[model samples]
Target chain A: MSVAGLYNYWIVILLMMTGFYVVISSGNLVKKIIGLNLFQASVFILYISMGKVADGGAPILREGITHYSNPLPHVLILTAIVVGVATTALGLALVVRIREAYGSVEEDDIHRQDESL
Target chain B: MIGTQLPALQVVVPLLAAPLCLALHRPFATWALTLTASALSMLVSILLLGQVLAQGVIDYAFGGWAAPFGIAYRVDLANAYVLLIVTTISTVVTIFARRSVASEVEAHNQGLFYTAWLLCLTGLLGITITGDAFNLFVFLEISSLSSYVLIAMGTERKALTAAYQYLIMGTIGATFILIGIGLLYMLTGTLNMLDMAHRLITVADSRTARTGFAFLTVGLGLKIALFPLHLWLPNAYAHAPSAVSAFLAATATKVAVYVLLRFVFSVFGVDFALGTMPLALGLAVLGTIAVLSASTVAIFQHNLKRMLAYSSVAQVGYLALGVSLATPAGLTATLLHLFNHALMKGTLFLALGCIAWRLGSVRLGDLKGLGYRMPWTMGVFVLGGLSLIGLPLTAGFISKWYLVLAALERGWWPVILVIIAGSLLAVIYIWRVIETAYLSKTNKTAGAGEAPLSMLLPAWLLAIANLYFGMHTGLSAGIATQAAAALFGIQP
Candidate 1:
């Protein structure tokens, strides 16, 4: 495949890897959650891109339309977006609790505190 | 009508009850509703299992939209067994939760706890039963979200960190699964598992399909607690409320395994997924390391709950081992272990919950001489521990025997040695607890009595099940073999 042809997938992979790295390497609890959201967003982009067809419009009933983007991935990603929102809300809530308990959200601080315990 | 709707009702009951539980501010009423809903789902699972056995796979399409267009709840021999395991454990844990939750959670938060518990159950059951790949992701998120909440509710503040860690790992896993499913949909243009299976056979060698398979395995590996990706499990289990730990230990990973089985054998075809790739051998190596390393680490844990949590990761290794064998006997052993391990771990965790109920801690030091103080509870723990050690006349032995037999069939004698060594490690860790509880002298100052009957009954119920299923393997082994055969495309 040409670079132009595969550029979309390349972007998706790059975004996903960056998000995964941020999650694994970040000490800040909130940063890790943001990384998670980024990772999921990359997946959403990949699905939506795959759904697209050349010169296609929204998947709706049109008399003159010959091609339409695949709608299934869009529907599936809609559900996934909701799941992502729920996860973010829950993650933030946990971070709040962690901050309250440890007085810090950094992984290093939590570890140090726990070790002292 | 009820029989016809059993598959949908199996998950829907708990799903609906979760909202009801949250809305009902009365703590007692919520607990009662959660318990009743769990029991009802368990009954539905039993009926579903019977129907699957007698009539074979039951396919129920949502809104009568038919497969490939709408989602389907497909109950074959495999997932029916899983559904039974999930619901049975949930029922037992719910029965035990009333007293345990009352003690661990603040009175006002009790309703929310029960709500999350039921939602988790619904998510697990839904993941086990759905035939649509996308539906599986939705259900996975439901269960995972609820689990984070449940773990966060632990009495200890550490539970928050554990819950956060789990949320991060679980979301990553779910995202990878979603990516895999999306790739498969792109390749096959179908989301229904059976349709995907049919479509995939033609393009099994395609690069996209191969990439999708890899993504699915790694993604699920994280969720299934497969060795290296299992860092989240120990803390999550060690710090969650006892009832949540028992419930999750007994059910969540088992359902994840069910999903792995569906993808490997049904969607991707074993020959292409395992045979073409070295996936089986790779999994076998990872499983061996998981078993050996986790068991060894478990031996050094000062906290009893953490030790058991490590042991759980080791147990997951055994499941992965069975999957790696990639034969009917191997699959059978995996399925049997799935059921057996749930019984052993459920019983052991519940017993610990009993101790936690009476003493407010499960530290090894705190448990000294509990043999005299809580003889019945400790006795149940002993039986459960023996099962964990794979001793004769316990549930653990039955699955271990099958695993050994499967390894021998493949002439993989080193795996047999690995299994034996793993058990020896289990013996050491389990014996540590026994030594602490039975051999050490009791601290007479703190007047701790036996755990209440409500707690004792459920723990013993599972303990007895461990022994009974070991002695009488007809049900578990029979269905497991049938499920394996079905996976291999054998009609019988």
Candidate 2:
């Protein structure tokens, strides 16, 4: 119930909203991809945050630290990060093709061209 | 070890085959690999379904770690059923793809097309079979990324734009889903769905759990293309290579709906989802809108593929409406439709692919008087159309019958009226194509011919399946009832 315990989650939410807002409001295709990257990165932070143990060390298999960070979330987030990167690459490639085809990366311009067609 | 290995093989077989398909670098060899991989996956899924059916639920812990601590693959009736749908569609589509891809895609890229097709198959099956929420997100991306490539492989220039639009929208949806999974993990500290479900029940009244639910619903709703979220669907389906459209329209959104169902019924618990929240009303309202709006829109489309795509949205509404009913009967209807619609739509799209292959376009005008030239193909189209319109003796009618009964059981007469109205709209659009193909005068300038036997076989196989299942309700309805009962936490 303490304010201190909820700080990490609040930051995660803030980051998520910022990315979502950019994706929704931006007209530029590159900016949308960046927003998507930020959005996925924020989720990565959330997953990592959940893995934290009180006074825990990194999730290494060494002998010293008694409290190990949750390895499951770390593993899950690794897969997610891979997916995020793949999506980003695909999005950027699509943007490049769009630029070539439509001569603009702006959403409105693309739509206008499509309408004219 | 073999028991432990089954889950990994279910996904890995298809995954490995995809790259091998590319390595083969010949259309014939690639097709063989793709078909073998899909067929093997289908066999595995059937076996897994039988195992799960007998043993209640089988949870395979990954890397030798237990639940709440490790990733797991949980196979229950629900996922097993979805796995069956994904693999079955992949198998049929692969057979259908042989001739269709030969005609639609470049000969050199046929290998690449098969590679992507196998990868897409792997992703869909993985999404259905995986128990870990994050793994679901990963598989979702895999399927989605390949789908964009597959859609872009169409011969039309418009296919690139359609793929681009779908890429943008699909990424947004995946991001939302990832965020939802992140929120759930933050709140419950678990990635395993069963573990998360147990934890969620403890924190059911918390704001975090409620927020997570909202994110998950919206994210999955986007994937399912629920009404307003369906803007990207029509273009993608219309422009994608005909085989890709058939496979995707039949399988992709259905799997998304399965994910939504899993999260709602299994992870969130029925009490919180159905009793405490307005989810039922929301689903019912949006579903009704999708049915009426999309069907109405479908009637106006000149392109047969685009028309069926819109109709797919309308059919999706019926599935959602079934879920909203929140009864065993209702869920049964939803599951039945999920299977039946896949058969019907898969057939419809395959028929369109045949038309596209022979006529070079599926425009209603282009189809004029072609029924005589391609009797078998047109016959398949008409049969699929009959199913789409929910006529009495087709697979579509069985689901609609059950859905209507479910609505009546809930005293939702208005929903019954909506279903009937939607079916009527379906008839109009289907009749448009029928009239164009049969009644209109033929043009001497347009040379029409029948599709190759490879295409006709898969199309007719599904068309006949439409009739076969319609008559013999025991298999589809029986399994669906058991699956739905299991979903509702009821024992058969």
Candidate 3:
């Protein structure tokens, strides 16, 4: 494939690595979740990009449309999006509880407190 | 009529019951519902196994839509065997949970606790049964999400962080899986496992397929708590409510192993996974390292739960060892250990739950003379520990026997030595607890007699099953032999 044709995949690689790096590098609990979200969003983009045909219309039969993008991936990813939202919500809720329990959301602070306990 | 619907009802019964648990809002009512749902699925799994044995594989499409398009729940001997193990553990755990949950969890959260338990059961059972690759991912999340809720309900303030840690790791693992599936879908344009397998043959050497395989392995390795990726487990297990720890320890990672077996053999084919790849060698080497390192780590831990959690990782190494051999006899060892490990660990963890019930802690230092005071609980603890150490005539010995024989058949003497060393390490850790409880002196648990007969009954039931199934290997080993042979397309 040409460079232009591979543009979307390059974006996917960049986004995935960026998100992954932040997840491992950040000490703040909320930032990790955000990093996770960004990581997932890259895959969502990958799926959406792969499903697209260069000149295809939406996957609905029309009078003159000859090409159509795949709809299955979009539908599959919708379920994933819901799952992703649920994960973020639960993650944030846990963060709230962690803050209430430990008085801090930084990973190091929580560990230090636990050590003293 | 219901016989044909067994596959659907296997998951639907618990999935539907989960919501009612939240609506009921009373602890007793929800516990009853949880028990009922677990028991019903246990029955369905048994019937499914019987049907699979008598007939052939039972493939049921959801809503009457056929496969390669609509989702399918395919039950062969392997899937049925895993279902049987999972549902049975969930049922026993539910029985043990009544009193455990009452004392450990807050009364207000008890209903939601059972709700999450039922949903977790749904997710586990669904993962075992689904033939659609994407549907398996959905069920994986269902279980993962509920387990996070279940773990967070731990009384310790640290439970929050454990759950948080597991959430981050588990989600990354799941997303890796999703990406792997997405890559495979791009190549095959099919989500049905069997169809993907059939098409994967043509593109088995493609770089994309290999990358997909890597993602799947790493993601699953994390879920299975393979040695290096096992960071979340000890804290998660150690901090979880005893019942939650017991339940997850018995079912979750075992189900993950089942998925790995399914994908490697059924979907990827032995040729693709082992022939082209150095998977067998890699697994064998890593399994060796895991067994030695995790067992050594387990030996030094003071907390019983944390020790056992690390031991669980080592036990997973044994399973990986068995799978690495990649022969029919070898897989029999894997499957047999998979079932027997559940029985033994379920007994051990449940017994620990009882001890924790009285003393409110699982520190090895806490209970010195409790073996005399709580004879039955401690007696069973010894029994489960014996099995954990692979004592002769115990269930662990049976599987380890087969694992060694499988290795000997390959003339892999070093692997056999590692297996023995792993068992010896188990003895040291287990003996440490036994010596502390029986050999040391303390009146700490003076008034704490035995746990209620209600809870002891279930723990004893699992412990006794160790002896029963250990002596009689027809049910566990028989099905495993057939499944393993079937995987290699060999005559049994």
Which 10-residue window in model 2 chain B sums to the lowest lDDT?
A: B441-450
Q: What tens digits encode model 1's per-residue C-alpha lDDT throughout B167-262? A: 999999889899899999999999999999999989989899988998899899999999899999999999999999999999999999889999
**How accurate locally, in lDDT, is each candidate?**
0.93, 0.89, 0.93
TM-score of chain A of each: 0.94, 0.93, 0.96
DockQ per candidate: 0.94, 0.59, 0.91
lDDT, residue B152, candidate 2: 86
TM-score of chain B of each: 0.99, 0.98, 0.99
In model 3, the runs with Cα more than 4 Å from the true position are none
Candidate 3 per-residue lDDT over residues B1-492, each given as its tens digit: 889999999999999999999999899999999999999999999999999999989999999899989998899999899999999999998999999999999999999999999999999999999999999999999999999999999989989999999999999999999999999999999999999999999998999999999899889998999878999999999999999999999999999999999999999999889778777887898899999999999999988999999999999999999999888888999999999999999999999999999888899888798888889999889999999999988998999999999999988999999999999999999999999889998856446888988789999999999998889999999999999988777754
The candidate 1 chain A region of ten consecutive residues with least summed lDDT is A1-10
lDDT of 3: 0.93
Which residue ranges in model 1 land beyond 4 Å of their true spot? none
Error of 2 at B133 (Å): 1.5
RMSD of 3: 0.9
In order of DockQ, best first, we have 1, 3, 2
lDDT of 1 at B147: 96
Q: In terms of DockQ, which candidate is strongest?
A: 1
Model 1 chain B scores worst on lDDT over the 10 consecutive residues at B438-447
lDDT of 1 at A18: 93
Docking class of 3: high
